[model samples]
Target chain A: MTKFANILVPVDFGAPSRRGLELAVDLARRNGARLTLLHVFDVPVSYAGMGLSPTELLAPMWDAEQEELDRVLAKVRDEIPEVSRETARGVPWREILAFIEQRRPDLVVMGTHGRHGVPRALLGSVAEKIVRLSPCPVLTVRAEDEA
Target chain B: MKRILAAVDLTSTAHLIIRHAVELARSMGGRVRLLHSVVIAPQVPPPGVFVPLTSFRAHELADAARTAMESLEESIPRELRDGVVVEIGHAADCVCEAARAYDADVVVIGAHDYGLISRALGTTAARIVNRMDRPVFVVRPMPTSHVVEPEPVSAKAG
Candidate 1:
């Protein structure tokens, strides 16, 4: 069997994202692969003009974000013993691409809003960009369609 | 994980796309159904005009697609390919329809290198991922290291 050794799953605390996480866990467990749960957070670039330093604005949220990342990965800890958590600070897709380059995960499983979800708030089209640019394969899981 | 619907084009890169589906089925214990969507323009006549041969193009393309897919099967793993379907319609729409018909757990489609317009106008894989009711595994075309004979101009199937 061809091994998907390193799998990366990006979460944004969305309902669809939860589905992506669970599926990633299934793949990791089946392949005995290492899984990385990633959450990218950066204080808005627009916030810089408000006289608040990036460090000051990011300080409190950093712990909270890491906590969320930890919590997300914790759900799979029992199933995937080798899973790890990653939180990056930048634009979501850019940070993800950099992470992919740094650690070339064989597969990336992430939640996507598809076309209608692209214009949704927060991670707008992040999955779209990742799917287009990632050097490896991407498995995009959408929430169950209401149709 | 039990069933995968793999959508492929007539290009050589489809061999690589089918391999991805095979590996996934091997790793997760599933069977794969191969599908090819033939791209035929819809011939909608002006309301007052009676258009002859309206369905002709569709039938012709579907037949060509079936032949092309048969050639593709010879290059892919036969055992894992449990079923083959040749659909005539938009690639993205056909893929989602096939996924529903197959009751596939995931849809595996080949993604191409980005064109300038792809971001604005989504790729078929992107469209299916959004509108589809299931997970999608998208494989990008990679430049092969070794030189092989280029595939002949392929049937307009994806």
Candidate 2:
């Protein structure tokens, strides 16, 4: 049988990421696989310079992001049989690569991020980096252009 | 997800790519169209004010690719085999064009061992993703040493 037992989706609550999640949910349903929604968490730069306990300073942010993740997951809970959520704290691309290495999902479904002062569509961004470095299949879902 | 366009390079990974395509087609109740692009190398005239005729035999390459594609097709279940297409031009362009012509819902492509150039610019798969409106599945090209040859389609059901 074709085994897509685990599929990972990195969400940023963006339109493209939502497109990716929708595709992933459908894929998981067809393949009878589970989905993992991973979101990279970053502490605001304001709290970084101070040598305080970063955990305490970032708790609220973490909680807030967790809630956001929950909200995202709730939308697809009924569609996927075993969908899970996670939050990683680091650079988005690096954290995603680390998660893939640690969890070794069969596929990664993510959306392409838009222009960020760099070359248009070239990204130099998370989706591009993950597409270049990811060890498994990566299905990139780009949002349809508005007419 | 009914129509899957699989772009394959005629390397060892071609077999693995076909396996992925077949498996996906089986699962999603889809039909797969295998596409191979015969990348034509650009020709330059002789230097020192000498202009000469030049030609790149893309047709021969396409024929060879077709033979190879047929070999790979043997491994695919007959039902899932939609067809095979051989195009002459840039790989990414051919893939997108074929996808559009076939009206494929998703495109499956293999990511290969790219050099420093692809790292700086972009891989073919990435370019396709940037341009194509639909989903593109980029299968990681496993290192040759670590790769295990795919078995027959009949035995792959396990």
**Model number with the top lDDT:** 2
Per-residue C-alpha lDDT of model 1 across residues A1-147, encoded as one tens digit per residue: 335888999888887778789889989998989999988896677787898776778787888888888877777898899999888888899999899868878899988654554432322378877877887788988765522
Please give, for residues B66-115, the per-residue lDDT of candidate 2 as tens digits.
Answer: 99887777777777888889998899899989999999888988876534
Over 4 Å off, model 2: A50-57, A114-120, A145-147, B45-56, B114-122, B144-151, B154-158
Clashes counted in candidate 2 amount to: 1
Q: What does TM-score give for chain A of every model?
A: 0.86, 0.84
DockQ, all candidates in order:
0.45, 0.51
Off by over 4 Å in 1: A53-56, A114-123, A145-147, B42-54, B74-78, B114-122, B145-158
Per-residue alpha-carbon lDDT of candidate 2 for residues A34-123, written as tens digits (9 for 90 to 100): 899999986577777898887787887788888989987888898886999988888889999899979989889988754433444564
